[model samples]
Target: MIEEIRIDNLGVITRAHVELGPGLTVLTGETGAGKTMVLTALSLLLGGKADPATVRRGAASAAVEGRVLLPGDAPAVARAAEAGAELDDDGSLLLVRTVGAGSDGVAGRSRAYVGGRSVPQAVLADLAEALVTVHGQADQARLRSPAHQREALDAFVGEAHRDTLARYRAAWAERARVVEELDDLVARTQERAREAELLRLGLAEVERVDPQPGEDVALAEEADRLSHAEDLRAAASGAHEALAGEADASGDALAATEVVDRAKRLLEQAGGHDQALAALATRVAEAGYLLADVAAELSSYMEDLQADPLRLEAVQQRRAALAQLTRSYGSDVAQVLAWAEDAGRRLLDLDGGDQRLDDLRARVHELDEAVAALAADLTQGRTEAASRLAAAVSAELSGLAMAGAELQVTVEPAEPGPYGADRVEMLLVPHAGAPARPLGKGASGGELSRVMLAIEVTLATAPDSGAARPGTFVFDEVDAGVGGRAAIEVGRRLADVARSAQVLVVTHLAQVAAFADRHLVVTKSTADGVDVVTESDVRLVTDEARVRELARMLSGQDDSEAARTHAAELLELSTVGR
Candidate 1:
């Protein structure tokens, strides 16, 4: 429950500190006395949108701060803790919101704080789900919407039902994804066929060529050797001849072998007389042996140097074929081989398109059946809760002096959606023997407010509502079009709701205000003696002040003695049940 709220520079309210308690508190004042501004302050604290124009003139910003007490085990307490918020020494959570301008001082900007620590505005909204429930003229208008009606029903069914709805949503999302994929596959069938045909043609060409990795490079080397065979053979024969002279070389220069033999024999003859000469003779023999080995290898090279032109011609043709494959598929034979491997796998998958389509069609049928079952389950849950909620709200209507006014919550079949395949509608049966009609066309503004209030009351009073109770309820002019006895009943119902939570109401009806456990008055003050208004202030009123305020609300003039008498009597009566 909110213990107190302070508004600074919000709307006409310069600074107003409202002390709230765990019961019904009422705010009443003349029209434009800023009663609605107090509600606006609460809205800001709950993360509602901010308006820079609502900020007081010449002020840099508008601020609203609230003190809320939470049980140690409350979900909101845990949520704040997750957000790294700490409770105050008094064990109360502090929530603050500020509205200012952007850098341009034209666009509105806002900030939120929880438990004295700055947090995102979304955190405040999350906390509000557990902290406050507000109803106003706008909410009353919302009551006519089918979506709102369905939400109210779902809220009444509690957590177990929520889990069911969640299951339905999860299934619905999966089905939507599957359907999208299936649709795309079916839509592009012709395109996939065209792609498969192209891949087949490319694969067949590669298979026919059968190019091997590195085969292109080996063929090129062989062709080069074959084309220059004559030049290569001539170079080898001349080198061999220089090392080993021909046997018939009578006119040619002396062969190297004969020259080496002559040198060795001369060295050997002189070696016997000198040790240095013997060492030289040994080195000359080793050189002769190495030269002989080279001459043998050169002789074999000349014997095997024949280049087969026919083989070279075949290599050239094979290389040209491999080159054609490379130009179409890859940079080289190795890359062409890799492309074949990948295309083989892709072709297999493309050829199996019929099988894939069959599988997708089967899965679609399965999901349709599964979703239909889930939708039916959802409808069952809603139908069950709808009847209970209708009865409870109709009972509240009876207490608000709207006897014979019945609320019928109908769950009709709707197309499957994220919520479910049920269309929930709230109908109003004004009296006995009257045909039930939709609330929008049937219920007057006053009737709608009362019905919305009853729905709220029913939701709040549900067993173990937990976070759904919201700890606080604020009604802004719920009694707008109600008067006389019905106004008193509206006040009484609000007070009854306050038994389990704090309730604050902004109303102008004197009878409704009479039922407040606390009464506050918003009064506008002028800066000077002229009629130009400057600021509005909120003050708690009691005894004579409260009576006079009620009297003024009753007759538009507090000085009327007759109105005072009536105000006193109503107050005395309203205080009895407390």
Candidate 2:
């Protein structure tokens, strides 16, 4: 049950808050009084498309929020729970949607919260659909849809054929899976051949080079030394000559070593004369020993300075090959190796082509057989269900004052589809002698509305529909083209339907309005260059007020004594029923 709905800046309804209760709630007013705005608000909140023109003149955005109370064990509650939304102890849910203004608009945002935890818009819609079904003239037209017709018929049959339906769906799904696989395999066969060849070529190229990770760095280092070998040897020889002081080279005092050694000897001779001079002699002797070690090391380095051309050539060639392989395959040897392994796997799969082809053929054959079996089962189920559904709907039509009307659920064979092979249509014969035709083609607006009502009443009690707690059913102008006893019957039947489900009727008929559990009066007022629509709950209408409102509905704006009397009598009679 929907607890309440609050609308803001939506159409002519600037700000209206409606508190809804159980049973039939009727909204009544003059035709142009903007009663449709209430239904528009509910529609937008239920994932309906938003049109910017529907927003009020001065409002920046339009928003609709609703509080829906559900049974604790309702299917909707389970769906919400599965979506990870929290549930209150009372099982009440909140749904809110706001559409921002502008052409580049962020249109229609929906949020569902249960016990204050956020959930997806889809979850909210699932819950909303379970709790309330809006049967606008437009939605009722959807009953003519093939899918909905099939569902309605199935629902009417209850669980007698449920297993057959389940088996059919499973088989159909498996067949679809096989068909998709077969198509994919056929499409990729040529591509796979090309891929195999490319991989084989790449693998051979990489293996020929045999590039090792980090081998590039070693080769580059060796190449650098080889490239500058002559210069390195020259520098080494010059350093050796300077340090060791060879013949014909600069030999200081003879060499730096001989000069320090002579200084040490002189200091040693003068040690008795000056102790500070003795310390200087020891420092000079240490300097001479350090110079001698430097000279010996430089000579050994010069001896090892010659570069081998063969090793340098090898390093250069190896580096060039590695660089070429890197360009062809990957930036590094590790990546190249990974690519090789993947290619090998793909090659094996492609090479064993005959076996895979055989497997695919076998799978396709099996799926074909399964699909046929499921189709047969589904057809049988529909065939059996159609007879019972036709009889039930036909019975409902008689109560709606269409005694000679023939209602038939015609199930015909069709090519196998996701929904199986049963094509269901509601065929109708308006008169006893008339040929049956599709309900949409045969029924007028008034007839269509009654047919939809009959279908709803039938499905409500059907076990397969799984609607244990029926949703709020809305009827938009179902009283159109109906009057007299038929009008009263419409009101009575709608009231009867309300006992099990919340029903909202947008009506101008006083007969229908009189039967309402709650009555809302919509009035339009123009204030400050803006249209404003207001709704007041008139469920507790005084005797005089009922006379005036019903009189206005029956005889326009006039409030004559006769109209008032008639209105009073209708209200009194409705009260007596209560």
Error of 2 at 428 (Å): 0.7
lDDT of model number 2: 0.75
Cα lDDT tens digits for candidate 1, 278-338: 9998999888888888889988987887888888889889988999999999999999999
lDDT of each: 0.86, 0.75
The C-alpha TM-scores of every prediction are 0.81, 0.79
- Tens-place lDDT per residue, model 2, 1-578, is 87788888888887888778899888887776777888887776665666767787667878788787878778977887786766557777777776666645455343444445665556556666776776767756787787888877766655645666777688777767777887887888899788889888988988888877678777888899889998988886676566555344553354556666788899999987998998998888888789889878877867776789988899898988888877877787677777778878988998877677788789879877877886787777778778877877788778777879978888888877877777888888876888998876777877777778777776775445532345788788877766665566677778878888898889989977888888877777877876687444213344577678888887775378888887777777766755
lDDT of 1: 0.86
Positional deviation of residue 218's Cα in model 1 after best superposition, in angstroms: 4.9
Best lDDT goes to which candidate?
Answer: 1
Provide the clash count, candidate 1: 0
Cα displacement (angstroms), candidate 2, residue 159, comes to 7.2
